[model samples]
Target: MKINKEEKTPWICDKCNKELQLSEIKVVYLGGSFEVELMQCPECKMVLIDETLALGKMIEVEKGLEDK
Candidate 1:
């Protein structure tokens, strides 16, 4: 899924109070790793995984790996 930072409301980091920027982050799951653009805090390096993503692509990938 493509997350356009410009189209959505900006997310704030709870710890750093910094506005989250769209960043390329490394994601690891079921022994697989890949880069995905996500909302992140520059200061604390915190990544936000929204519910839709957690329940959507991530879940699908997890099931696919399990089936493999």
Candidate 2:
């Protein structure tokens, strides 16, 4: 799944003080890995997983993987 920055509020990286950019990120779960677009810091490479995604698609994928 692709995650785009649709929110009006921009996310900033606290460590780098830089605005997060929408880019493809590699996510690993249960020994599975996939790439998806997400907000991340270009300099620090810090990825942001918002509450909505954590509770929604992330949870769904985790459950689906665990069931397998």
* Clash list (residue pairs), candidate 1: none
After aligning candidate 1 to the native by TM-score, how far in Å is the CA of 12 from where it should be?
0.8
Leading candidate by TM-score: 1
Which 10-residue window of candidate 1 scores lowest in summed lDDT? 27-36
Per-residue lDDT of 56 in model 1: 79
Alpha-carbon error at 53 in model 1, in Å? Answer: 1.8
Model 1 TM-score?
A: 0.75
Worst 10 residues of 2 by lDDT: 27-36
lDDT tens per residue, model 1, 1-68: 98877796679999999999999998887776767889999999999987877787788788889899
Off by over 4 Å in 2: 1-7
